[model samples]
Target: MNMLIFKRFSLTILILGTLVACKETNKNPQKKISETITSETQNDFLGNYVAKEYHQRTEGYDWISVAVRNKGDNTIGISVRSRADKKRPTCTFDSKAFKVNDSLYRACSNGVGILFSFKKDSLKILTEIPEQADALQFYCSGGGNFTGDYGRIEGELDSSQIDPTLFTKTLELQGIGFSVSSFARNNKKILQILPYGLEIDNSAITRTLEGSIADVEIEDLNSDGFPEILVYLSSDGSGSYGDVIGYSVNNGKSISAIYFPPISENDELKKGYMGHDEFSIIETTLAQRFPIYREGDTNANPTGGIRQIEYQLVDGEASRKFVIKNSTDFPEKN
Candidate 1:
């Protein structure tokens, strides 16, 4: 296995979805909190929040900004950024935060976990352990103090203050990890993926994306002891069509892609298929589900019920492909 000794300042790649994820080491096991939180209570935390010295702007003064969004199923994704300066004055923490209480959530980046405490229109961060506050200096200049306090911004965050990173995430399994990020450059949406801990060097993967990324999942689908990374993407606009990009570690040495044929190319599966698909790793199989569309149906509603298709990852003539294992249809519910 790769000799990755997590130290006082080890890198913990963090991933978040809804289009992007960033990297960071999760120093501790994920918090096992009650699953009884309501959607309304969670939605209260979604917004663009900003921090300014004296609650007012000063010439040539820098600032910190936080953006919060819901990742569906009661998950909250938070991003913290700051105006870059000459030195390593940049502070970045992007990850899905776990709810700790009605007014608090905790997120970790680079082995240092911090709590998000919300009160009224303002928000502040306190480290899970007081000593860890000193570690935050690793992300900034001169080993300074962590500075991220903000009042909810009424609208969007000022474009000039935040960096161009739109989405990022890192997913790991069996000691292998993939750091992913998406940004706009030269009018094109670019997707960059980098992998670490392979005996053979796996160069970073970069390509143009037709649609925005939705989520990324990792699993050893074939029980190979190695891991595979699955990236789900969704098209913009009403259709919200979904697709997957997969990479499998080659015998614990290298990486390769898994072929996923388009539904429009298949006669049996495309009979009543539209967009709006969902994908997940269910035990040993990759499962996809979507509302079945019949003739004269609008995008909003489909009366034809739902269709679920499960695929098993198997070797093809050369690389790998997800072969359909089972397909089922359920009638529309009342």
Candidate 2:
């Protein structure tokens, strides 16, 4: 009877141990399922997307490609490339994680902290620093066509309305300084006309003029049917006293004259005169044909002086009326 009791106790202990082991086995599977779901859901955003609206404001292109890839070990990586210029891929975002289309995305642990979300087809960029929001907008939209000229921006156009090939050609033409105007067609020549000097060049569009020019007056001065430009040259330390140089656009391009009052002229009327200095040009009305030159010393505390020179173009020649110098401001001729 004691032996039977011992056998029964042993059986009871075996049954309890089996039940506990079964419970533990069931819990392990549940934990595993949870981990699998997290991994699958978190990586749903790994893929490539194209920027739809971002192509409009940037370097004259229609689309930019954005890519998100999983970097193993719970991290993500992001990159961007332009459809127009593929050679220049801007930057990379590492360790980035965000939601896209109701899916979670994550980047590598050691990458840039850039995150992005999707609203339909557009990307909503997020960064660890709030100020980076503005920067991301710029990055996405800054792919417009660069004319490769003097930083002139070429606007992106609707693909349906304009041909991309033709648009690019137009931009290239403008870069070379060719344009259509009412005055001239296929105007391939460019000239630099300044008050102190004139530079005539077929490649004027490629060069940028550096110097202070004030008060530009464009007129049919010689009545040769072409516009003549008048400007004032003021003297800094680099050059001499201010003088007026006139250029005639007629007959291609030519310097008509450099105006400097005779030295024997009255001292009061020449108070602001620098033998050969620089000047600024102020634009008044078309009827006023006089050029006003601002004169002053090159040193600190330079004295203020104003000189007014009246000019008329008759038969392709510049005729000077009179010059008046004043310490005070010169009144605009009515």
> Number of the top candidate by TM-score?
1
In angstroms, give how far residue 20 of model 1 lies from its true place: 22
Model 1 TM-score is 0.73
Per-candidate TM equals: 0.73, 0.26
Q: Per-residue lDDT of 151-175 in model 1, one digit per residue for the tens?
A: 8878876665456776777666788
Q: How does each model score on lDDT?
A: 0.71, 0.34
Superposed Cα deviation of residue 296, candidate 2 (Å): 14
Provide the lDDT at 107 for model 2: 23
What is the per-residue lDDT of model 2 for residues 1-334, given as tens digits with 9 covering 90 to 100?
Answer: 2323433433344334323323422322211212222223435555555555444535555444455555322334444444434334333222224232243332211112333543332344434333333434433345342111111113332333221111000001111221111111143221242222223533322212223232233444444544555544333353334434444443443334434454336555455444443222222211211123355445332334223343344442454322333223343232
Against the true structure, candidate 2 reaches a TM-score of 0.26
Q: For model 2, where is the 10-residue window of minimal lDDT?
A: 166-175
lDDT of 1: 0.71
Q: What's model 2's overall lDDT?
A: 0.34
